[model samples]
Target: MMRNFHRWVGLVLSLVLFVAALSGTALSVVNVLEAGRAIRPASTQTVADLAARVQVAHPGLEQIRRAPSGQVSAWWFDGGQPGSAVVDPATGRDFSSADPDPVRRWFTEVHRSFFLGDSGRIVAASGAFAMLLLAVSGTILAVRRLGGWKRWIARLRGPLAGRLHTEIARVAVVGLVLSAVTALWMSAETFEILSIDEASIGAAPSPSGRTGFPLREMEALRALPASSLRELSFPAADDPQDVYVLKTDRGVGYVDQGSGKLLGWQGLGFWQRVSETVYMLHTAQGAPVLGIFLGAMALGAAVLSATGVLVWLAGWRNRPRIPANAPAARADTVVMVGSENGSTWGFAATLASALRSAGHRVHVAPMSAFHPSRYPHAQRYLILAATYGDGDAPSSAKGFLGRLGELRVPPSAPVAVLGFGDRGFPSFCGYAHDVDAQIRAIGWR
Candidate 1:
């Protein structure tokens, strides 16, 4: 059931999830490159010093914003035209254009909402949720396939697609889960479903009618280091009531343009901090190493999704169609098959045909549907079971062990076990051995 659930969900959400993962990977790469090129300000620099220098360099400076990569940017109005530039915080010297990279912006839009606005956001959120589910379910299934958590990294023997799928999943599922969880949180915050209190400094005090107080003299601004500065908006030109608006990692505050006194302050709420942290984690804005790691995982997700679809299709194609099978109640012999890729079903079909040729009624069914009590006329039971990864029970036999344990009384009919697996694996035919032991424990002949 878990395997089927994982398969069908992957098939349905593969396209959207793939697109999200691919775009996220691209964005993370861009973030890492941008971080590499970003300018790092001196630890001793204060926001007051940086703001004062920027104001002196460009008298029309309107705002100073500090990026997560520690890059400082300035926006100004020169001769009635708006302009922006990356600036050296120590000297307030222009170094680069502030315009965003076009490719990075495009990737950002696609990653966030697929450029579909609100509707796209919903789709993107759904994709994130699907990825979370896939990761969790895939983890459980992998654990089961490996026999137990202890053998999670044991040698795997299977077709290339299945091996690749499991190998990549085992390595990347943690990162994928982190990315998906953070994405979902950010999406909720974006849509205002998480209820983060908007940072506000309340109503600015009517600026003292006085003017000409240097920003460097502002006590509140001077107390903050450049590292904590998020953004600072200068008081409006020629407006006595305008106040310097300061936003920092800790909170938002308004400074009187003339007196340089803090007018009002609002600290970041718990949920607001959580939202910001989630944003940083999801975007990898401040951490290049994490960004690269997540990018690799995203790539793995793409490959895993594709391989998963292929494995499912292969299993479907290999499934055997039994013919002229007798009913369980009337059959003299019962053949139960447990298979992951349907190979054991083929063997069961052959065995059933041979039994029929000898004029014995044979009923062929999955081990999952095993109910010896339902087969009253059966004289013997034949178990054809195939082992999965690391000696784990195959998909079709997942429930057989539990059902077998639930049997109040062992069947009177004699039983034989035929195990199937490649010897290349360390735990060859492990599930079959387990079944045989279980049957013996239940006193089956």
Candidate 2:
């Protein structure tokens, strides 16, 4: 019963989860293409040369700064006159001011939070929670179908919906968890409680006065590789007091404007680094394989959602509708049920559709409402409930433990129990095992 309650709630949340996963997949590759196109000539260009080139163009410029994508910023006579342009690595052509598609930004907003801000954050977090539930429910379903968790690893039967759901679930569970955890982490960071902010960094001062013409020297700029740059800040002015601020994947530091001399470096805090990595992993930046993985997970999420609905709808359409005057719960050939949330008198009423149709007057009721008297005319008792968290019982079965102890019945009834669970959990269907043992000890004769 406790398990059943968890199941229905999980089912409803699967819809939102579907959206989150699909959007994540789309985002994984979208920006990758954009990043690839934002190319520049020699990603390793020096602050001095880049400064001179853009400075020659923007005479009023005090300095030149470069973005991660090699976009150059000419900070004019004053920083306020900053002019930006993307520099093509092959041509040194300016492309910095290029605007990415607004549609992509919009899509990002929708994917991240449905554009609701804090509430959107909750939505994303809630979606992660729902995904966790789905993975769990999928595992439970697989274990029960295989007769036991021990059996599930080897001899599981291959029912289409159940089999497909579990197999893909087993393979995709890791990816799903990766995605969910990162997404949740991002959501947490968005809420500010996680505090992923990096500390403020000030570059070391350059040699004061008499700036050398480092811009004309090719060898100095060629010494550094393009990949090392995260972003580069050129000297602030001709006074040579300003150094090159280079933010790299490893740390933030300054470079001597004339000699390319490396300066004081500071690394990012753990939380800041972790947050940055998580965002990249969640979006598959720099690694196409991870992006492909995200896409596959999205595909699986959709498949699981579809099959779940198909499995439920199929059973629903076929389930018998028993009349109120039907024979004793024990005498009826079979029992059937139609449910929404599984919160109704499910365990104490009727267990499920197929079990009720198999020529058995099933004793079905919400787990909390179950009474031994309800099965007075039955010989066999069957319980089909969905398992919730790490094998916890659903809400409908909350009273199962207490009621099982309270009810006294003839010691001749034998029961068969079936449970449903997601395949993403370690303890799938654990609660069902607990329930079955209790039923056996009761000696329902």
Candidate 3:
């Protein structure tokens, strides 16, 4: 049931994921490049120092902002016209235009909202949710097929699509899950589904009636290291009642321009901090290495989607449909199949058809559905099971061994086992042998 759900959802959402993934990968690369090009401030440099130097360049400086990439930008009014530029923290001068790269902005829009605004965000969030489900379900299915988590890196055997899907999923599942979960959280925050309590610093405190205190001498700004600065807004030139608003990694504060005093402070609330951390994790804004790694994993989503569709189509092509199968209680013969990729089902179908031609009533079903009491009218049982990794039960045979073990007594009918596998495999037909052995051990003829 879960396999079907995973397969269908993946197929439906594959294109959405593919586009989002590629865009995200591009964004990650952009982030890395931006980080490389950014002029980082010296750790010991204070906001006061940067602001003072910038003021020298623009006496009407209105604000300074820092990006997670460590890039700085300054906004100011020159000759009655406002201007903004990326700042050189080393020299506190205009380094470049502050406008974002157009291509990067386009990609960002595509990845974040698909250019659909709120509706696009919802669509993007849905894709994230689908990716999350696929990651989790695929992991469980892979673990089972591989026998256990410890054998996660074990050799794989199957069709090319299946092997490729499993292998890529094994390597990229962690990153994919992390990205999906973070994306969902961010989406929730965006839609206001999550109530992140931001501790308020209250309205900006009334500034001292006097102004013109030197920014470099402002106690709060001087005490703050440039490394922690997020943004610093200078008080208005004409408004003596306005105060300087300082935002940093630690919190927000209001500083009286004339008095140079920290009038009010508000540390980030727990939820607010959590949201920021999640945002960083998802966007990889501050962690370029992680961003690149996650980008590679995202590329897998496109591959996985394509391969998953191929695997599903291949199964449909090869899996023979059973016709005229009888109910377990009315059939004289029962064919129980345990196949991983549905190949064993074809053999079972052939066997059932042959038995029906021989004037016998035969019922076909997966071994996982085996229940001796349900086959009271059965005269014989034929088990067709394919061994999985290291003798583990195939997908359809999962739980059959446990169910068989719980039987207080074997059915009053003869039974036979036919194993299917490559002789090249060491544990070839191992599961079939186990089933036969368990049957005999329980006193079944």
Candidate 4:
């Protein structure tokens, strides 16, 4: 029963999942293209070098925004950066890519939040929930077929997509779940659900008796690399009170607006900094090294979804009818069947054909299709049921017990239950026993 439910639920979400994966993989390669666009060959200058350059150009300014790539910008305003520059990759010379460019901001917003704000948050949360269901549902079905966790990932006999589905699912389950949960957490955080203390958000600068320093150090700045800098937020104003904000993946720091002296600093919490790290890894953001591998797996996923749907639809469309090809009361054979994937139906039909020449009434029907009226002339009855996960009945047999209660069968008729299954499954022959008990309960004992 659970197996069929999982499969059907997955069918509904598979299309959405395929689309999301494709778009996400595309967005990951943005960095390579952006670097190509810069035309300067993507150079990285140091903090010391940028500080020296900015100090010389904006002597009156209290703060300078130094890019990891050696591009410099000055900030002394409440709303935004005062000015900016970029380094030419070809010449190792300074140029300008100016801050607050609408293009960059627009792309960033779209990629991060899809520009939908609250609506986007809800949609993302829904996606995460859907993904969680996908992982769990896949896991439940896989484990049932393979029997136990010991051999869950072992080789199984099935079509190409079915085989790949199990194997890829084994390897991808962890990453998939992590991505989903992280997405959920991010959605919650986006709406300010996390408790935030105003003190930690921002604080006023401490009193510094020494307002300015004459000489600034360049060694540290010169050694900095563009790859290390995540973002650089400029100072608020020209007032000596303002400080330059230097943000790295590890922490944040303030430097003297005038002298470039390092000042206050705060280390971001471990998990807080980890947000970007996992997001990049999960989405493949700006990382092309894994491009081929991710692309291949994504294609495999698409194939898996498409084939799964086809297999399911074909089964549903060609399901076995209630009555088998047999005349009334004359034949001495009967076949009772239970199946989730309908693989058992083929076996039942084949069995009926072999017994035809022997002059037996071979009845083939789902467990739910069982009724006293169908076996009017049966001398012997055989129950063929396939056990589902953890010794559970197949979907076709879930209600068979209740139906047996509603209808009483003739007494003392010879009856036998035969369960078909692969030994690899732990629940081998399990549910067929339950069906036998149901039959015995109705005076077949």
Candidate 5:
């Protein structure tokens, strides 16, 4: 059942995930490059110092913003013309154009929303959600295929596509899960579903009718170190009521232009902090190394999707077609198969054909589809069960034990279990043994 769920979901979202993964990988590379090129501010540098220097360079300085990577940019109105540039906190001078790289922007738009705007964002979020499910379900299947967690890195014996898919998943699942979870959180915040907005800072207090206050002398901005600076907006020249709005890692504050006093302050809200952290994790803005690591993992996601499809196709190609398969209600005997990767289905087909040759009407189905209620004429049940991770049931038999326990009274027909697995594993045929024991306990012969 889990295999089916994992396989179908993967197939449905394969293209979406592939595109996201490629775009995400490109963005990650861009992030790391940007981080490398970014200028790190000195610890001693304070927002006041940076603002003062920028104001000196551009007399009509309007705002200063600091990125998580410590890159600073300043915007100003010089000679009544608006201008902006990447500012060096040390020199407070334009070092680079403030304009975003078009290529990076394109990749970002594609990654975040697939260039579809709001609808694209929803689709991206859905892909993230699907990726998460695939990761979890794939993890379970991988562990089971390997026998157990202790054998997590054990040598795998399977077709190339299946082996490659599992190997890549083992290495990339952690990163994939991280990316998926963070992406979902960011998408939630973007859609206002999670509400990361800062708590209201309340109405701005009446400025002390002050104007032309030196930003260097503003107690609020001066006390704020460059490390914590997010943004600082200067009050408009024509508006006496305007104030210096300072946002920092700690919170947001309003500073009186005339007195340079902090008029109002509000600490960062819990949700806002969570959102920031999620953003960092997802974008790797503040963590470039993680960005690169996640990018490699994202590439793995694409590869996994491709290999997963190949594995599915291979399974279908190799699946043995049963002949004259009898209906469950009319069959004198029922043959249930519990297999991963469709291998056990081959055994079921063989058994069904043998029963038919003996003139016994046989119904063949996956163990998960087991339903004695639909087989009233059944004289016996034949179960071909395979053990999965740590003696757990394989994908096809996921709910078989539960269904068996749900029965108020055991079936009167005799039941036989055939176990399949490698003896190299400790739990070899464990699931089949479990089925046999359960059948005996339930009074089945």
Candidate 6:
């Protein structure tokens, strides 16, 4: 049942998941490029030093912001026109113009909201949730196929599509799960369903109506190192009532322009820190190497989705359908099947048809529905079982062993157990072996 659920969900959501993965991969690449081009300042420098240097270079400086990557940017009004640039903290020189990349921005928007704003975000979140489900189900299926968790990395023998899907999923599951879970977390925060403390700087102190003190001498700003600075908005040049607003990794604060005294501060709450960490990990904005690794995983996810669909289509095309199958209670020969992907059912259908052609009453049903007492006139029983992960029962056979144990009366009919599975698996036909053993223990002939 779980195997079928995983397959159908992947089939239905493949396109959306593909688009999301592709866009995410592209965004990660863009982040890497942007990180490479950013101008990083020395760790020992202070926000005060950067501000002082920037003020000298651009007297109209209005704001200085630090990216998660530790890159500084400054915005200012030049000749009554607003401008912004990536800045060098040491010299306060503009290294690059703040021109957004259209392609990256477009992908970002599509990735977050699919260009549909709020509705798109919900869609994106759904995709993420689907991906998470696929990862979990796929892992369970893989473990069953391999015979056990201990042999999870064992070699696999199967059709090309199945093998490829399993291989890629084994390596990429961690990253895919991480991405999906983080995406959901961020989406919850976006919708205001998860309340995270917003950084707050208390009311600004009343300006003294005097020119602000030297940036180098501002005690509050001097205490904040460049490494900790998130953003620093300077007081407006024309407004005496305005005060500098400082945001750092620890919290937010307001600094009096005239006295340079720290007016109000609010430390970041635990949830706020958690949210920021999740954002950084999800976006890989602070770590280029991690970004590249996740991008490769996203690419792997795309491949996994394609291969999974192919495998499902192949299984569906090959599964057999029986016509005019005999009723379970009236048949003399019962063919019970335990199939994960419908393959064992195909074998059962063929066997049942062959038996019926020989003038024997044959019925085919899932192992879970097996009832020896129901086949009162049965002469023989044929069991076709497929082993899933870790020698565990497939969805169709989940409760069969327990049902067999509960039988009040053992049948005297002859029984034959047939196991179907790849030889490369550590516990080949494990469930079939269990079925055969259980039948004997129950006193079946």
Model 6 residue runs over 4 Å out of place are: 323-334, 345-379, 396-398, 402-406, 409-413
209-270: candidate 3 lDDT, tens digit per residue: 77888878989889989989999999887889888889999889898888889999999988
What's the lDDT for candidate 1?
0.89
lDDT of 1 by residue, 275-394 (tens): 888888888898999999999999999898899888988888787788999988899999999998877888898999999999999999989899877899999999999988668888
Q: In model 4, which regions exceed 4 Å deviation?
A: 29-45, 51-117, 195-227, 233-239, 274-281, 284-304, 320-335, 346-365, 369-382, 387-392, 399-412, 416-445
Candidate 2 — which residues are off by over 4 angstroms? 1-6, 35-85, 95-97, 147-159, 203-207, 210-212, 216-223, 238-240, 256-260, 327-445
Task: For candidate 1, give the lDDT of residue 261.
Answer: 88
Q: Model 6: how far is 45 from its true place, Å?
A: 3.5
| Whole-model lDDT per candidate | 0.89, 0.59, 0.88, 0.59, 0.87, 0.86
- Compose the digit string of candidate 2's lDDT tens values, residues 1-445: 3235334655687677667766766776675565566454454555335545665566554444444433443444434554545554444445556454676677688777788897886887888877766666666655554546565555333347755666777678778878778877887777776876664566475453445545546343445555555565567555567676666666677666656566566888787788778987787766666677787887787677766665555545533343442444545322212122332224424444455565544434445555546556666555666665456665546657667766566335565666665566556766677777787677653
Worst 10 residues of 3 by lDDT: 421-430
Superposed by TM-score, candidate 6 places the C-alpha of residue 394 at a distance from the truth, in angstroms, of 3.1
Per-residue lDDT of 10 in model 5: 97
* TM-score for candidate 6, residues paired by index: 0.86
Over all chains combined, what TM-score does candidate 2 have?
0.69
State in Å the error of residue 104, model 5.
Answer: 2.3
Q: How far is 186's C-alpha from truth in model 6 (Å)?
A: 1.7
Cα TM-score per model: 0.86, 0.69, 0.82, 0.68, 0.80, 0.86
- Backbone clashes counted, model 2: 50
Tell me, what's the RMSD of every candidate?
Answer: 3.3, 6.8, 4.1, 6.3, 4.3, 3.2
What's model 1's lDDT at 26? 96
| Per-residue lDDT over 100-164 for candidate 6, one digit per residue giving the tens place of the 0 to 100 score | 77988899998998899999899999999999999999898887677668877777766789889
Q: Which wins on lDDT, candidate 2 or candidate 6?
A: 6
The number of the candidate with the highest lDDT is 1
Count clashing residue pairs per candidate.
0, 50, 0, 16, 2, 7
Residue-wise C-alpha lDDT for candidate 4, range 1-445, written one tens digit per residue: 5566667666876665565455444443444444344432235655454444545555434444433223344433323445444544333334665555565456545534457777755755675577677778878777766766887767675445556667777776665676567667666667777533211225536524344443335222444654455444445343667655667656676656555555666777766656666555555534555444454444444555676676676667546564457753454676777876677877777777777656666766677776666666777777778876557777777787787778644534588888866555555677887777777777774
